[model samples]
Target: ARKGVAKSEQYEIRREEEEMRSQMSCHSLKKRAVLTTDSGNCTAEEASESEAENSSMDEGDDEEGSHEESEVEVLDEKGFRRTQEKKISNVKQTELKAVEDEEDDDVENLLKEEEEFEEKIDFSADTAGALKWKEDLTQKAAQVFLRQQQSTPNLRKLIYGTVVEDEDRE
Candidate 1:
């Protein structure tokens, strides 16, 4: 029974240690991911540094055949690292492009809206101009009608007296 208790305690301790180790590893991976992303932001700077390193590595690679094999392995490692960096940079670039596209679309929409607003303003101005002309026409018509009324003092006399004047001439 004591042995069984000891075994169970050992099992529990081992399980707890495993869990803690897994948690620590997860935390470390998160930290590394964050660092990688932060470093990835300086792509131009890193590219220059990598170019210098590659030149130095190439010089080292030229020494011997056996050294060349070792250099190939190192180059493969560097290649893998570069591919990951490139993927991160590509993702960042695509995100920037998407943001720029959205801004362009917003600008286009604003321009279209402004054009529509200008059209509406122009239409309103034309309508106002037409209304002013209509008002002027009505006033002119009224004045012309008043002048005709003044020329012919009475409507009945103008219609009836003309016949009387013709009969007098006969």
Candidate 2:
């Protein structure tokens, strides 16, 4: 019991450290940066469209080996939303020293890429006059997809009904 409690405590510490790292990385975006996307609000139709896209992609894609990163959007403290690709690498490979080195390099490269993206989105100077909202469509889609998933409690009500949910409620 003592060993088990110690292990669980260590696991929680690790989780908190990872959360802090994610927060720092996500918050690095500049406030004054004029993001290319002007996404005002997410709607039901938009959510459905994202669901359809996700469903179709799920059906046709069984080759999980080919995909390394899955896109997810994290909202910062300032409510600035930016899309990031979350690495879903296999845990079996975690022991590899080469993979560790590669991941370190990848983190550095990812930071550089984010900086470049922020720079690209900043159109505060003005020049072409035509604003490009099309560039961040995929990011918008990812956000919509996340929104739908986050509403899973509503889905639970529809599927399991209030009866089952009520019994489980604290």
Top candidate on TM-score is 1
> What are the per-residue Cα lDDT tens digits for candidate 2 across 1-170?
99999999988988897797555434432211224321211121122123222333343342232121111122132322232221112211221322355555564454445434542332221112222344454555456445655666576677887787776543
The TM-score, computed over Cα atoms with residue i paired to residue i, of candidate 2 is 0.22
What does candidate 1's lDDT look like per residue over 1-170, in tens digits? 99999999988988897797566555555554554433432232223222223333334332233223322433455464453344334333333444455554554444345433443343343334323433444345445545644676766557787677566434
C-alpha RMSD values across all candidates: 43.2, 21.1
Displacement of residue 13 (Cα, Å) in model 2 is 1.7
Candidate closest to the true structure, highest lDDT: 1
lDDT of 2: 0.37
For model 1 the local lDDT of residue 129 reads: 38
After superposition, the stretches of candidate 2 with alpha carbons farther than 4 Å from their true spots are 31-170
